[model samples]
Target: MIYFDKVSKVYPPSMVALQDISFTVEPKEFVSLIGQSGGGKTTLLKLLLAEEKPTEGTIFFESVNVNDFPRSKLPELRRRIGVVFQEFRLLSNKTTFENVAFAMEASGRTPEEINRDVPHVLELVDLVEKANHFPHELSGGERQRVAIARAIINQPDVILADEPTGNLDPLNTWEIIRILKKINELGTTIILATHNKSIIDSLGRRVITLEKGKIVRDDKEGRYVL
Candidate 1:
């Protein structure tokens, strides 16, 4: 469903963030991107999202060349993808339910659809009882779960999770990973970029390792070696 072909991203002067990176993610697949900091894992995700332009080669989402798309078309492309961040990027003012509803609202979904889907997604993340709670009232794990619910509310075909569990404890990290796996089982393609070796080692899923701006290994049912 997604392909990166000979893609390279060169920053100003001579800093190369990604060098000739190439990979494909099929539908409903759970793929882990494991690398140390500044290994181009995040840069590759940005290039695919058209947030950063690649200096060479192309990225394809299905048949369309992502690099060739105009900026106006980016929102349309992004709606097909969802993103979760290391810090749970929740609204300080909004409650848990409101936070998730905000995404559907931004998508131009009606109040009726928002009401129906928001609760269901909150339930998926086991946050329905705390739907009225503010981000400050929640634990780090709860806040992150709310973030995940918000990301999946629109039913994006692919989820780009960048260090989603970085701020959590071990049990919470496992909780987040379990939820991600559940989401994958429900048929969404998952591309997880993480720094946690224990999480990666336990996954037993396809892992693509990046090092020094290049792919060093690609394995099926892989363990954490770095």
Candidate 2:
């Protein structure tokens, strides 16, 4: 459902985030992007989310050239994809339920639809009981779960999570992985960028390794070789 053709991203002067990266992710696939810091894993996610444009080449989402997506149509493009950053960008002032509800509201969903979908997403992430709590009131893992809920509240076609377990302990890390696996099984295409070797090893799915903005390895059932 996603394709990158000769994609290269270079910042002003010469900071290359991705170089000649080309790949295709079929619909419903679970893929892990594994690499060390500065390998451009997060940069790839930003490109896919259209947070930044490619300095050269093109990005296509389900055959639509995302690189050329109109500015006014960004929301439509974003609605099809969900993004979760390592920082768990939840609004501190909003309750967990409201945070997820806010996503639905942005999509112009009706109140009835928001009420119906918000709880379902929270339940999916196992944050149903904590829906009334604010970000500070919840533990780190719970807060990330809320972030995941908000990301998926719209039933997005692709889920992009960048270093989702960056701040969690081992137990919480596994919990987040389990939820991601469940979401994948439910048919949401999952693309996770992580530096955690054990998680990628255990996942045993397609893994793409990037180094200095270039993909050095692409393997099925891959290991963390970097």
Candidate 3:
């Protein structure tokens, strides 16, 4: 389980990005983090990634405190979690297959593992035909699928999607959502941070709503009321 205990982040000059936030995410759970922009949605995700330090409180991944990890060990922590972002952050020079392969390579996977897993995941994302296409050669939805493919190539314990469908049309948005749901159903945990009401309402999963850096609502089988 992942636990955020009384976590808070305050920037310089009295800006509070998060305030006394607390929550727990069980294994294989699909949770949505929803709120308006500047409501600490991004900040909270960053803290989980150890990209920023919390001003107070603790974040626990299983038993260890994420904040206590040394810089060298941070990579180990991050390797267990996958992150997908609004902008499909792919290498402009690499093809779809190479883009996903690069992630496994960075983690020191062997040639055999890379050769075996890359095609399998590409097929999972229905990108086998576009495996040789570069980012510039693909559509926005295809690029995002490549991003998602890269994120899941390592089979991380959880996937954190930050406004992943923000740039796609409704058709593509649902496509991405379906892919995420498939991943979750396959036993990977998913923490989706999005503001699309239709997506949230359609999900009917756990919703944790934040407003001005405070959690205003949390419900199972939730809809996007805010």
Candidate 4:
């Protein structure tokens, strides 16, 4: 459902984030991106999300070139993809339910839809009991679960998770991984960019490794060999 064809990104002066990278992620597949910091994993994801324009080649979402999307239509493009970040960017003032409901509201969903979907997604992430609690009241794992709940509440076709477990302990990290696998099993395509070797090794999924802005390896049932 997603393809990057000979894509490259270069910043001002001389910073090359990606160089002639090409790959395709099929529908409902779980793909893991592994590399050291500044290895271009995040840059590749930013290009896919249309957060930054590519300096060369093209990125395609299904059959449409993502860079060809007009500014006014970017929101529509973004709605098809969900994102979970390491920081767990929740609203400090909103309760767990409100946080998830806000995503639906932003998409112009009806109140009835928000009410129905929010609870279901929270349950999927195993956060139903904490729905009324604020972010401060939850543990690190619970807070990340809330973030995941919010990301998937829209039932997005693809989820881009960047270091979603970076802030958690090993136990919490595994918890988040399990939830991500569950989401993928339910038919949502997941592209996970992480540095956790154990998580990637245990997953035994498709792995893409980058080195200095280029793909070094693309393996099915790969390990975290760097």
lDDT of 3 at 153: 95
Candidate 1 has what TM-score? 0.97
Cα lDDT, model 3, residue 181: 100
Model 1 CA lDDT for position 114 = 95
lDDT of 2 by residue, 68-135 (tens): 89888999999889888898999999999999998889999999998888888888888889889999
- Which has the better TM-score: candidate 1, or candidate 3? 3
TM-score between candidate 2 and the true structure: 0.98
lDDT of 1 by residue, 69-140 (tens): 898888888888888889888999999999999889888999999998999999899999999999999999
TM-scores for the candidates:
0.97, 0.98, 0.98, 0.97
State the lDDT at 204 in candidate 1: 92
Instruction: Write down the lDDT that model 3 would get.
Output: 0.95
Q: Output the lDDT of residue 46, model 3.
A: 96
- Cα lDDT tens digits, model 4, 182-215, are 9999999999999999998899999999999999
Error of 1 at 166 (Å): 0.9
lDDT of each: 0.93, 0.92, 0.95, 0.93
Per-residue lDDT tens digits of candidate 3, residues 41-149?
Answer: 9999999999999999999988889999999999888888999999999999999999999989989899999999999999998999999999999999999999999
Which residue runs of candidate 1 sit more than 4 Å off their true CA positions? none
